[model samples]
Target: MYRLHIANKNYSSWSLRPWVLMRQLDIPFEECLTPFESDSNWSSFRTFSPSGLVPCLEDGERVVWESLAIVEYLAERHAGIWPTDDEARAWARCAGSEMHAGFSPLRSLCPMNCGVRVRLHAIPDALAHNLARLDELWQQGLERFGGPFLAGETFTAVDAFFAPVAFRVQSFGLELGAPSIAYVERLLALPAMQQWCQAALDEPWREAGHEAEVQESGTVIEDLRRLS
Candidate 1:
């Protein structure tokens, strides 16, 4: 059996990728969650992952760190996680890699807080740029592949890669065009997403950093700032 070590389900976006992929592929794995606290020890994670990050996967003697790497590894074992068509597979890989490497502004401004809702009072220019690019990408993918998903009717690694973005968009009330809006709805409707959200709702852990600034209307953020 595979062992996957992850952080909090409510906040760890990176951890979600491999977890979602595994669940979607029906691959059985043992999950271990490590909380993020000042007093939390890092030695255990460091020993398992060279990068000292959550979302580390251990399959027997093989160890894989990084969410995308783990997803790719899992894809190797379960081929259908990627597209079957050669051209579509290439495009899906590109889209997934772009999501893995880019979107820093979105990550910083809107941390994945599944339990809290926040509205943006003012979006920073960098975040605006990031959102614009994301919108463009989503539009292109939808138009090209004719989705409910990035690569079309089926959910591929691309969808797994962008799932957190869908969560962030919903959490922060980000404005998406028609296609993107429809796409988000489809993502939210997924059984795996529902399961993930249910798990997040059941978790009892809370942190000050995860708290949102609540106004009379709702929680709001004044500016976008990258956490790291």
Candidate 2:
């Protein structure tokens, strides 16, 4: 069985990616949760991950870090995780790569906090640009592949890569076009997402920064659930 070390479910966006992939694929794995912001020394993570990041996958002697790398590794092991056709697969890779490298401002401003939903008062131009680009990408994907998913009928790594973006857009109360809204609804309807949300709800660990932000915004955990 694969062993996955992850951070808090409520805020670890990178952890969610490979975990969602594993769950969606019905891959059996031992999930070891390392509460983010805990005093626990993450020395063990360094042994497995060069970057000392969460979402490290240990498969026997092989250790893989980085969410996208882990997803690609699993895709190699399980064929259907990526689109089969060459052209579609190429587009899927492009989508995943863009997600892996782009959207820094959105990530910085709207950190994933499954336990809180605070409306954005002012989104910086960079973040707005990122969101606009994301809207265009979603539109392109829907146009090229049709409704629901980035690569059409089936959910792939590309979809997993953007799942956090869906959460961010919803959490920040960003305006989404009809197509993007529809796609987010499809993503939320996935069993994997439901499971993740449930787990996040049950998790006890809460970062102080996130808590303070929630308090300042006057948004509670219940408010966050409503956003979902």
Clashes of each: 0, 0
Q: State the lDDT of candidate 2 residue by residue for 1-228, as single tens digits.
A: 999989878888999988888888788999988776644436766766778788899999898888888988898788679988777789889988998998888877778776556766577799789888999998898889875688877888899999887777666677878899889888877899988987887776667765565455434434544324
Q: What is the lDDT for 145 in model 1?
A: 79
Clashing pairs in 2: none
Q: Find the number of clashing residue pairs for candidate 1.
A: 0
How many clashes would you count in candidate 2? 0
List TM-scores for all candidates, in order.
Answer: 0.89, 0.90
Worst 10 residues of 2 by lDDT: 218-227
Q: Which parts of model 2 have CA positions greater than 4 angstroms off?
A: 38-44, 210-228
- Evaluate model 2: give its TM-score: 0.90
Candidate 1 — which pairs collide? none
Q: What lDDT is reached at residue 5 by model 1?
A: 91
Q: Rate the local accuracy (lDDT) of all candidates.
A: 0.80, 0.80
lDDT of 1: 0.80
